[model samples]
Target: MAVLAVVSVAGLIVDDRVLVGAPIWAKSLKFSVSFVAYCLTLAWMLQFLTRRRKLGWWAGTVVAVTGAIEMVIITGQVIRGRRSHFNHQTPFDSALYNVMAGTVAVLWLATLILAVLLFRSTIADRASARAVRIGAVLGLAGAGLGFLMTQPTPGQMRGTSDIVGAHSVGVPDGGPSMPLTGWSTTGGDLRIPHFVGMHALQLIPLALMGLVALGARVPRLRDERIRAHLVAVAGAVYAAVLALLTWQALRGQPLVHPDGATLAAAALIAAGAALGSIAALRRPVGGNRAGTPERTRQPVG
Candidate 1:
C-alpha cells in the first residue's frame, strides 16, 4: 500500500499531458491511491475472516503482487503515451494487455475464494461479518461487469480492429466524458456501476462501523440484536442501489441525465431501503442463525 501511495503521488506530480486517449497520469494516479486504500482495508478484513495465519499471509501477498503489477503496467503505458487497456495496436501492447487481464483474473478469483471462506465460517462480530459477506458478493458482481467492456460493440469493430468496444454506450471511447473520471456524460458509462460495485467492500463495512459508533453514544442504539438487523438491511439497500445503477447504464442512460425510468427505479430503491430499516428496528436481529435459532450472543468487540 505504501508503495502504491508513492506511485500515486508521483503520478499526480508529473505532467498532465494526454496520452493515447485521456490524461494518462491522472487515471493511474487516482487508481493507485484508491487501490492502496482498498488493499489495506481488505487485508484488515481478511485477518478477521480466517484463523490460518499463513493462509492469510499468502492471500495478502498474492493480492499485493498482482495489484502492484497492474499499477506498474498502467503507469508504464502512461509514460510511453499509450493506452494500457484494450490496446491491441501492436504485439508488445497486446501482450501487456493480456498480462494485465490475467493478473486481474487471478486477483478476482482469490477475492471470491476468500469471500466464500468468510461466508462458511463464523465470525465474532455479526455486523462486521454481514458487511463483509455482502460487500464481497457485490464486489464480484461489479468485477463481472468488466467483461462487458471487453466485447466489441456493434459497428465498433468495423472501422478499427485495434480498438474493441468501450465503457460508454452511446458515446465512443475517448469521446466527450465527465471531468477527471472520464465517464461519459452524454451516454451510459458501464464504469459507473463497475466503480460503485467494487467499493462495496469498503462502503458496507464503513457503514457498519458508523452504526457501532452510534451505538457507543446512544443508549437505545446499544443493542447488538438491533445493530445486526440494521447492518443487514443496509447491505440489502446497498446491493439494490448497485443493481439500479447497472440497470441504468445498460439502458444507455447517463447517470447525470436520468430519464423517467431511472427516476422511478431510484425512488423504488430508496423506499425499499427505508422500509428495510424500519423492519430491522422492529425485529429481533440475532434470532435467525442460518435458519436455526441461537440465543443472542454478546456484543462484538
Candidate 2:
C-alpha cells in the first residue's frame, strides 16, 4: 500500500486528470495510505492478545486481505477515471461496488472479533490496556461510520438511478469540497467524522506515548495509577470528540461552520474532559506498579 501511495503521489504531480472534482490519484493515495496505517496498527495490536491469539491473528488476516481488496478496487476505479464509492452508473460498476461492500463487511466483522479478543486479554500496563480496549471500541464505531455513507441520500431515494448513495448531506458529492480531503464544505460531510473516528486506534496509542514521555519529567505523573487515570480521561475526551463530529455531520452542518448547538455541545465536552482530568490527577496514587500484571515481550508480526 505504501508503494502504491508513492505511485499515487507521482500520479498526482504528473496527471492533470480530475475525478469527482478532485485529483484523479487523490482517493487512491488517501485509501492506500489509510490502509497502510489500518493494517499496520492491527498487526501491532494483535500482539497484545495473548488469549485467543490465534483467533486474533486470523481476524487480523481477514482485515488485511479485505483492506487490500478495497484498495485494489479503488485504485482500479481511479485508473478508469470513475469514482469508486456509490458509483452505480453501469452494471459493472454496481457489481464492483457490491463486491467491495461484501469485503468491507467481512473486514468489519474481523475487526469486531479482534476487539472482543483484546477485551478478554490483559496487558501489564493498566493505562495501555485501558487505552487499547477503548481504542478498539472507538475504532470499530468509527469504521462503522462508513455504513452511514452507504445509505442513499434523500434525493437519491426520491429519484435516482445512476448513483445510489452520498457522503455529503444537503449537497451533492463532487461539489464545493474541502481541498485535500474532498470533504463537503458547503454542507455536512460524513467523511469528516469517519476519518477522525477511524484513526482512534492509532491516535490513542500515540497519546499514551506522549503521556509516558511527559511522566519522565513530572514527578507525580511517574505513578502508574496516575498515568492510567490520565489515559482514561484522554480516552473519554477522544470519544466525546468523535461523537461531536458525528452529530455535527448528521445535522447537515459544515465542519467549518458549526452551529450554536454544535458549539455548545463541543464546549460541554471540553468542560467535562477538563473536570475529569483534574479529578483523576487529584486522586491519591495507589499500590506499587511493580506488582502489576506482567506483559509478555512479543515480537510484532
Candidate 3:
C-alpha cells in the first residue's frame, strides 16, 4: 500500500486524465492510504486478544487480503481511465465493481469477527480497554454506512442501466465535491461520514493515550476510574457525532451546509456531550486513598 501511495502520487503528477471530474489517480491514492491505516490498526489491536490469537490472526489476514484486492481493482480501473464504483457502462466494469463490493462486504464481516473476539480479550489498561471496545463498535457502524451508497437511487430506479448506485444524494456523483475527499459539496455525500466514522477506531484510542500523557501534569486525570470515565464520555460523544453525520447525509444535507434543523440537532448533541465530559472530569478521585496512586492491572492474558 505504501508503494501504491508513491506510484499513485506519480500518476497524479504525470497523468492528466480526469475521471468523474477528479484526478485519475486520486481515488487509488485515497484507498491505498486508507487501507494502510486500516491494516495497521487491526494489527495493533489483535495483540490484545488472549485465547483467540489464531482466529484473530486469520481474520486480520482476511481484512488485509480483501483490502488489497479492492485496491487492485480500484487502481486497475484508474489505470484504464474508468470510474470504479457504480460504473456499469461495460460488462467488465460491472463485474469489477461487483467484485469490489463483495470484497468490502467480506472485510466488514472480518471486522465484526475481530470485534467479537475483542470483547473476550484481556487489555491491561482500564481506559484503553473500554476505548478499544467502543471504538470497534463505532468503527463498524461507520464502515457499514458505505452500503447505503450501493442501493439504487431514485434516478437509477427511473431507468438507468449504465450505473447502479451513487455516493451522492440530491445530486449525481461527479458534481461539485469537497477538495481531496471528493465529498459532495453541492449535496449530501455519504463518504464524509463514512470516512469520519471509520477512523474513530484509531482516533478515540489515540485520544485516550493523549489524556494518559496529560495525566502527569493534571493530577486529577491520573486516577484509573477517572480515565475510564473520561473514555466513556469520549465514546458517547463519538457515537453521537457518527449518528448526527449519518442523519445529516440521509436527509441530503452536506456536512458543511447544515440547515436550521440540522444545526439545532447538532447543537443539542454538542451541549449534551460537553455536559457529559464535564461531569466525568469533575468526579472526585474516590477509588484510590489519599496520596496513594492507582495500581495498574497486569494483562489477564
Each model's lDDT comes to 0.77, 0.85, 0.87
**2 or 3, greater by lDDT:** 3
On the 0 to 100 scale, the lDDT of residue 21 in model 3 is 75
Q: Model 1, range 20-55, lDDT digits (tens) per residue?
A: 356657667677876776687777777665556566
Worst 10 residues of 1 by lDDT: 292-301
Model 3 misses residue 37 by how many Å? Answer: 0.9
Per-residue lDDT of model 2, residues 199-264, tens digit only: 998998887777777876876676666777888888889889999998888888899999899999
RMSD (Cα, Å) of model 3: 2.2
User: How do the residues 101-203 of candidate 3 rate in per-residue lDDT, one tens digit apiece?
Assistant: 9999999999999999999987777887898899898889999999999988998899856988888888888888888888988888888789989998889
TM-score of each: 0.90, 0.94, 0.95
Once fitted onto the true fold, the runs of candidate 1 whose alpha carbons sit more than 4 angstroms away are: 1-14, 51-53, 284-301
TM-score of 1: 0.90
Candidate 3: where is the Cα deviation over 4 Å? 286-301
Worst 10 residues of 2 by lDDT: 292-301
Runs in model 2 deviating more than 4 A are 288-301
Candidate 3 lDDT score at position 59: 93
**Residue 50 shift from truth in candidate 1, angstroms:** 3.8
